[model samples]
Target: MTATRAPQGQEETRAGLWARLGDRLIVGGATVGDHGRDGEIVGLHHGDGTPPYDVRWSDTGRVTLVFPGPDARVQHFAPHAGPSAVRQS
Candidate 1:
């Protein structure tokens, strides 16, 4: 069988995004609570090279808040899986 090659640079992009998000969340005064806890990652998108994802959190089916930042900021938060929503905040 022939060996399959993975996509080039995709991993790097993802890593970069993750780092950016982590840094921004730290700087923006956001904290990551329990994964299956009270809140959920409700949104994600590419921000202009600063924070990539405009993450939203919800508790009890109501949107509690939104976190928008530089593209780098959102990248780190993109790994979460849940309902999708975007709000400018």
Candidate 2:
């Protein structure tokens, strides 16, 4: 994984990322009152805690820039390869 710095003028445009880098994002059922997609955060476009993530989607194996919505949830991948916490928004 590479360290990412915030983009020019992007810090003022939005808040922050829904999940941290290397975190797993589950959509659809995890989406605020919705259900549907799942992915792993492979890159960050801003600060470590910032938004507009580069997600490598699980189903498609494609990387996409994502601004996670209310239905998003994060599963912190542990050193042991297990989920440490499952936090929902």
Candidate 3:
């Protein structure tokens, strides 16, 4: 629900985001929001009640989060490239 901007000339990488999320889940035992991808920590609500969060990428290349459950469905739209693929206009 809050937004923080990255430093100038600095950008977040997907691997870094994933690592951060993994570390947070492992250490904090709570969910977190991935600002880079706009994903939320849906919490583990299945076996251990730590439901896995889903990442939904938008057409504009932005990503969002989806809570776990029957409502959470993976929808693949396009193939995402690495940071190398992001070229400034």
The candidate maximizing TM-score is 2
- Kindly give the stretch of ten consecutive residues in candidate 3 with the minimal lDDT sum: 20-29
lDDT of 2 by residue, 1-89 (tens): 99787775343223434455667888666446665888878887776446677888888999998887876766655433433354457
Model 1 earns a TM-score of 0.24
Task: Report the C-alpha lDDT of model 3 over 1-89, residue by residue, as the tens digit.
Answer: 88887765554333212221211121121345522322323233344323354333432444344443432322211123332344589
lDDT of 1 by residue, 6-42 (tens): 5753433333434333222322334555233233333
RMSD (Cα, Å) of candidate 2? 9.9
Q: How much RMSD separates candidate 3 from the native structure? A: 14.7
- Candidate 2 global lDDT: 0.67
List the global CA lDDT of all models.
0.35, 0.67, 0.32
Best by lDDT: 2
Ranked by lDDT from best down, the candidates are 2, 1, 3
* Local error of candidate 2 at residue 64 (angstroms): 0.5
Q: Rank the candidates by TM-score, best first.
A: 2, 1, 3
The lowest-lDDT stretch of 10 consecutive residues in candidate 1 is: 20-29
Which segments of candidate 3 are over 4 A away from where they belong? 1-58, 71-89
Off by over 4 Å in 2: 1-18, 29-35, 79-89
